[model samples]
Target: MKDRLAASYWLHESQYAAMSSSAVTERRRAAMERFESEGFPTVRHEDWKYTSLKKILKAEYALSSPFSEADESETLEFKDIKRFLVNDIDCYRVVFINGRYSSWLSETTHQGFDVCTLGSAWKKYADQVEPHFGRLTEGLGATVQLNTALAWDGLYVNVPAGVTLDKPIQALYFTTGEQPVFTQTRSLIVLGDGAKAEIIERHQSLTEAETWTNAVDEVFMGANAHMHWVKLQHDSPSAALTQHSVIEQKRDSHATVHTISTDGKFLRNNLDFKLVEPGAEARMFGLSLADGQQLVDHHTRVDHLAPHCVSRENYKGIFDGQSNGVFNGQIHVHLDAQKTLAFQENDNLILSEKASIDTKPQLEIFADDVKCSHGCTVGQLDEDALFYLRARGIQRKEAQALLMLAFAHDAVADIQHPSLQAKLHRLIGKKLGVDMG
Candidate 1:
């Protein structure tokens, strides 16, 4: 009976009956075949060992169709949140409602920046699109394949070379609908040489709608370019999200990724980077706080293919309830990549025995005369520290909140924007159920 049920479940999710464009038709068909051959990736998969898909693929869920009416105001704008904070960012805004682009909610930029749907870009930039589109994350995994097959529309941000916009481009994906849907949204962000920009990508849900969102984004930081990318994923309890961020760094480019994940029934993230030229540097800062029966996972790889490159990574997690968290980080140093300095550290704190974390820090060094180190630490709150806070006239709840804040400070401090940092601190305080001055 178990085998029969699992097989039926896999077939339902594997259902593919439509296509919107023939842009990547051949590649999409090949991906569908790969999904059929690979079947569903269970705990047996190396990267998914800590997560269980039995609940997500139970054969009873319905796939969400193309959204005709996705209310952005009813979904993403929360009364309790500072919605005005998102108002001032200058770059063009593209909003996706239930996996489909919502033209009513999003408008095109008049000048300087070009914001269009992925399908349109596929038609317009046909020659240039074929090379970079769907190329970097081709061989990732089953979820990625599923995204490639089911994705109908996404966002494309193209900044003319040497154009520096004062505003940060924002893309918001709302994943709330009637049924548990699996949707893929792709982004191709191109920065011409000496371009300067900031981007903030927000992913969230409107209702407690059960759904699965598989998203992918490709960022090309041209030579001497600077970018700040923020990915915020905090949905309802009945949602599952998997996102892949592939960043390609050219000569003298600096790009930093700040990831903050708070909610979701299940979550997995892959942040892969390729430093293709000398003097390229990338820093990845991530934080996840899981409560309830949630399971959050982060898997990252930073590849140093060229010499004189540097990469630094720091990821931290705090869990309560029966939540489970996983962190797997790999730093690869290739041959001829001399003077490569890389550092990676993962820290996890579990507040309950039922809540657990599994962290693994992996390093692959094939070159000589390079400095690289990776480490991870998992533990609980310190009682002595708690007592110290109490002795200092801090209440119990405040003490826990204070400790949690302190634990996440390193990650929070890395945010490039002070407003963003303040917002994150407020959100973290609320999620931890702590109110402090």
Candidate 2:
């Protein structure tokens, strides 16, 4: 055995690979090889300066494999959103419990859409799936690769050419444990030419368990295709989550991602897009609310490799109760990629002096004929905005919450899903001390 493969003995290689039929085995081997050279990432690493995993290492949490949860109520929530068809209609649904897929609560009845267990798809499309399945996680860093190496049950959704899904496909990942447990989920979504669809990825816990989920999702948009993604993450105080997403946009296609994070002990997310062809368009929008010592981080990168492409990004968050947050956006424009237009912005509000934020918005351009700009702002509640609202007879706490929500409305209103928008609004309202339900 090689040196990298040596430490892998601590992990269950085969059982972990059993979840998705994709080229997980090969990716696992490659990741193990990489892990051999670079053990675990430390705070010394630039991308992970604020997030410390040493505490987790000492927590003694079990590395969750294919263990069954007999205590779970066997209930899954896909229609957790009002307008979602995944709960009521013929929309496809995939449910994963504690990092494993439960077929009993999932279905694949959508016409013209091929939905299969990640394991099954791997067996048939090993060659195609192997190459891209682990690419994003590998580029993401340590925890993500660890997720790819240990993922057991995930889903693969493929929408064929010109086929528009009737309802937003839903993926719900839930947990049912008390101790500190770990879960890594991988999903691959491919939208063929001219296909249009909405995907809702929801994360919640059954028992508010002290769990950690390192999830990676990759989307490939073919020519002229359009794809919308909504991610909702809310869990107990003991839960920690790290999610990474990579999107590839082909000629004349559009890809958009909206991520909402309100509850978690520690959470970090990485989102990127590669414009490989002309006319490609990409947008990323997110909102986060952190309270009670929670920490949330979001990092994004967009590479303009071709000319005549466009990209936009916006992220906002509210930090309260000594919680912390971070946002880093790096946009790259390559030479010869003329006519490229890209804009990135990050704005944050701190509800308390104890709350903190680290914001870095960057731009690296090698093209002379391109237009690219990036900026970030870290500030407290707009006193003027609050006073203005209160001048109109609004209460103090209520006025502050309203001002913060108004600051966040830009990103939330951009969401195209009404049901999802309402859910997120309620969550934001709750964070602002309003009755969400």
Give the Å error, residue 130, model 1: 1.7
TM-score of 2: 0.90
User: Pick by TM-score: which candidate is best?
Assistant: 2
Output the TM-score of candidate 1: 0.89
Worst 10 residues of 1 by lDDT: 12-21
Considering every candidate listed, which one attains the maximal lDDT?
1
lDDT of 1 by residue, 93-156 (tens): 6787677776766665638767677756766766555667667778878777766655556778
| RMSD (Å) of each candidate, 1 decimal | 4.1, 3.5
Report, for every candidate in turn, its global Cα lDDT versus the true structure.
0.76, 0.76
Flag clash pairs in model 1: none
Off by over 4 Å in 2: 1-24, 67-91, 435-437
**Deviation of model 2 at 56, angstroms:** 3.0
426, model 1: CA deviation in Å?
A: 0.5
**Model 2 Cα lDDT, one tens digit per residue, 1-437:** 12322344345566555644535677776776566666667889998887776644555555556544443443455443233233333456777777667777777654577675565567675655776677655666766666666555576877889998887778877765666666677788788898897877876655555776778878888899999887876766777777888888999999888888888788888898989999999999988889888888898989999999999998998898888898888889998789999988888888788999988887889999988877778888878888898899988888888878888887789787676678678778887876655
